[model samples]
Target: MTDPRWGEAFSTAFAQLTALWPDKVAIGAAVSGLCALMETDVALAYICFGALTADMTARVAVCCKRNRPLCRGLKRALPRYVCYLVFIVMAWAAQVAFQRGLHVGLPIVDIMLAYLILTDMASIIGHLHYLGVPVPPVLKWLVFGGREQLKRKAREAAGRERR
Candidate 1:
């Protein structure tokens, strides 16, 4: 006959294992989902970085055409690029932590990414305008502000100058 103590020990071990199985499965699923989300975010960040680099290149080209010192323009731009890169990385990390740890449903990361994209687009549009490319007035209004706002500001400045 089988020993009673051995049967009891085996049953106890199986019960404990089964009890912990759901927790393990939950943790595994969370980690898997987080990894997938992180991968998507990384790809998007790379695209944002590419846009920023293009903007920087356009600025440098403008500076070069204007007979400015290339080194000075690059020196001014390099720090800004580095800061943006750091911001992207930090934003990714913070987003992951908040979304997973705090269970936040807010779209903070999406807003940040959109802001970066819009800023780069505005810079590119400005550079194109400087290069004598005829960007549509509507684009300028959309990216910078409405034409009425600009006119108002100009009128205010002129009014101040007369005083």
Candidate 2:
């Protein structure tokens, strides 16, 4: 049988080890939060890109239906999409390295994720426009500098050249 003194000593050691329980709990929560954020960012990125790809593919099919087969457009677009996916993955890896390896803060990761989301949204908008959605001119201008805006600028430049 264990001695009563030994039991008392074990309880004392256990109590001492658990004295900083709050700090340990805080650290665990923080790590768990960071992991969840990383996972969510990745999932969001994938969803955004997937939607963008589908929209773009549909736009290509519609645009090329008269001139070329849909399969040809898909063949051409597949490599470009693959390249974009690779770029996104590399960027994500760099962000992770900055956070984990270099001990960078969360704001940088947040900024990168925001940038990814905005760009994906913009591309999706552009594709929607190509698919004949009547997206607002102001929104197009805000997101893409507007095709009409570029045409107007070109016309202004031509008028100045005429002078």
Estimate every model's Cα lDDT from 0 to 1. Answer: 0.71, 0.61
| Candidate 1 worst ten-residue window by lDDT | 105-114
Residues 24-44, candidate 2: write the lDDT tens digits: 888767655654655545455
Number of the predicted model whose lDDT against the real structure is largest: 1
The TM-scores, one per candidate, come to 0.56, 0.47
Per-residue lDDT, model 1, residue 133, is 89
Model 1: per-residue Cα lDDT over 55-157, one tens digit each: 8898899999899998877887678777875665576687677668866544445445556766777888989999998999889778666434544654674
What value does the lDDT take at residue 132 in candidate 2?
Answer: 76
